[model samples]
Target: MCDDGLMTSPTHRAIALLSLFSVAQCWSGAALADRLGVSPRTIRRDVNRLRDMGFPIEAEQGPEGGYRLRTGGDHYLAVLDDAQSVSVAVALLQAAAGAPVTSTADSLRAIETLRHLLPSSVLSSVKSVHAASGTVDVGWNVPPDTRLIAELAAACNRKVRVRFRYCDSRGRVSSRDVEPLRILTTGNAWYCVSFDLNRQALRSFRLDRITELTVTTFRAERRDLPDPVRYLQQNLTETPRWPVWARVRYLAPLEMIVGEVPRLYGSCRSAEDGTTEVTAGAEDWDALAGHLALIAIKLGVTMQPISPPEFSDALVRIGRRITSFGAP
Candidate 1:
């Protein structure tokens, strides 16, 4: 009833064009008008406004080149420094690296998009980190099927709306419609944070148990969702899956890996020897032991298969069980 024409309609259209460039492969004003149910004249007005706002929209003549996105159309990513680029790359690596199924894939795609957007010098700096990077793997548990994880993560990051089969604590399966917000890893599990359309609440679904997933059309209210990591600590799964508790000392001062790989339970205490000892609980002792073995850091882990034994014999048994091929 009211006239948006004099106020917001044109402004909204212009912002929408910029948003299109921020995401897709290509966009044309004529096609855009068809999508928005407006005239090509209004689309032209909006396009010019977007050009004023610094969107490098390419409008070609004759016939084929109706409209296209130029390479540097996004001005936001062009300003990052070399160090910032590497830092972002590290964050992307951290996000997807530990999530069992190529879980951090969305972040990786964003990382690539960012890398391509950066200046050459900044990109070189980002690449330099890979070359100078030291041994930093914490051997986090990730999903075995990376393809599915990647697809789910992409859906969540783009707020693409999704549906997936979820197994409840009792092992019963149900289909859930979710607006996946983030992919998070804690200790050994990968979690998907989303707003549940059915439950009308925010829920964390375990990614490993997610057998099937598909993108949906139900978009989420992107602004109000909770942070994924905060949601994990609050919802800590009710199943109480892990049964073994392990303690280990870090090779370097505990401060080194503390920020990167934190203890699942108590404090990772520092010893007089400059190393830090960490305590953790896991349901599968052998699997936990395998994680420690890959770190290969000396004295880094001692599995306690049975509670109350601080000695190495029980841990040695667990290691043997996991390795299986090792001597008795």
Candidate 2:
């Protein structure tokens, strides 16, 4: 598109080329030359210029060969227009608000750097919107390490093997060597779905519980796997590791309970009797009872315990304890 009287100098042509490479995975030399209105020889020279400037531009030989920019390189600067710049600023602000413990500082520093680079007029508008907007904590008490997440993401993208020490929910520690596949978030924490080499099965690890992470040099062959997000959802919902599973019927509408409960934490549905049913898991009956108690307190409503005699007994115990607290 820049070939239409906009690309005047070689520098402008190179910038245009960089912009093109950023959007798509690969572009043939002939197509690039045609788009830039330059000779194939000129395109080759521009590619070389970009490589010399520390952009990891990978070029292949032959007719079907093309050039692509690789991610996780040592140097990468995104070229953004004014609107794109404003969008990035807004996204960074949101990220800073919800980012994990270690990454909040990084997000704030990035916002500061981008503000300094933005034009004065654009910066003024961004500042006004930022002043009007406020952030709420998402209640992420135990978030994953930012550096570990980056490392695992790079390994997944590069298709490499990684080894890490993992502590499971039962406090059992084990060393795991696996091929990192995908990293997903449950709005509160991060999880990595990987193929476990030793166990010979697919596994999902909570990123916060991982330690001693090491990315190996071995290239991992891609396996015919199911959709990653689906796999993660099934793993979380179907195979809960908690010991106690309970269902409670809240005397509220389904829509109201759905907004209050995160999907990753529980599943909610409307009962035939016009109450909302929520099925969730907890480490023990006491913990489950406490959670339900907190919900009742927060919503100022009643919850009919659906099942699990243990949970009901625990609730009675908790009620007696509260009654005693009032007496003495």
Candidate 3:
């Protein structure tokens, strides 16, 4: 038996031996015996057994010679145990749901092949995982073109600048030259977080809106950047595009609102008196006021507007309208 109790069986040992061979360039017979806690003769027998099973294992006999698997052949086989195969199947299922790197049809076909190859118990586990995870309908489920994403990703990795035409929310198109820093996905959409050379600032461009992309030969100078996701969220929630900024004092404990208010809406911090202070930006006073009312109603707690006195006035107007509706 092997030192590791799990791979004691011949089948398990063969899998483990193949795993080692795949990673290393070569392993001597004595070294293989020492690692598996078996004699050199037993290792010989195991090698013969794997060869009979049609694995392209090559053996050499000398001080430097040992065993290695062949590659780059038309008749290649993927070596995976039941558990690893099931894991790959689950990953394929997620990719099928929506992965920028793979088309849904390709992922689904791969998943179906895995299902046919997996054992009954393993298939059941895959089904359970899919059922438990459920599904989400992200508003914009369309991913960016896979080839376009590949180009942008390569630019980011190469630390190179790229030029592209971008369309903003108002349907205006403009050319931009930027240093591609990262490719990020919010599940609903994909974005390329970059440093705009022309604007001389960090910007997040929606991948769907990008066109005429060309990778430039210019190398980009690295700059200190905040966490990409946080920076993008800040750009979305705190930018001048959102005209009204409002602060609210929640009467509840900080923990109560921390999870309820998403970061894209605003930032939340604990106040001195054990309350949660949220600073959010919205289109207008009425919009912010209505947002606060919805949160307060959901949390079943009282809240007061803390800034831009107009927020308080808007809240009063909403309350009066609600009261008038009750009178009718």
* Candidate number of the best TM-score: 2
Evaluated against the true structure, the overall lDDT of model 3 is 0.70
Give the C-alpha miss distance for residue 249 in model 1, angstroms. 8.5
Model 1 agreement with the true structure over 1-328: per-residue lDDT tens digits: 1134532477655544544454564666577777556777877777777566545566877555566656643353444455555656555556655554433544545555554456665655554432222112233455334344455655755567888899965578999988877665553455677788899998877777787688876667746766666666655632233466566666666666465343343345677977666565554655555555445444454322223364345457756676786656
lDDT of 3 at 327: 90
lDDT of each: 0.57, 0.71, 0.70
- All candidates' TM-scores? 0.39, 0.59, 0.52
TM-score of 2: 0.59
- Winner on lDDT between 1 and 2 is 2
1 or 3, greater by lDDT: 3
Greater-TM-score candidate between 1 and 2: 2
lDDT by residue for model 3 over 154-235, one digit each (tens)? Answer: 6877788999999986678999999987766544566788999999988999889999999988999969877666777667
Please give, for residues 1-328, the per-residue lDDT of candidate 2 as tens digits.
3445755577877657755664565899989988888888988898898777655688888887899766542334345555555556555555666777534554555555445445665555445434333333223445545456556766887789999999998899999999988766554566788999999888888888999999999998778877666777777766666778888999988876777765545678999988899888777888789887778778887998989888889999989888899894
**Runs off by more than 4 Å, candidate 3:** 1-145, 167-173, 217-241, 316-328
The order by descending lDDT is 2, 3, 1
Candidate 3 or 2, higher lDDT: 2
Tell me the lDDT of candidate 2: 0.71
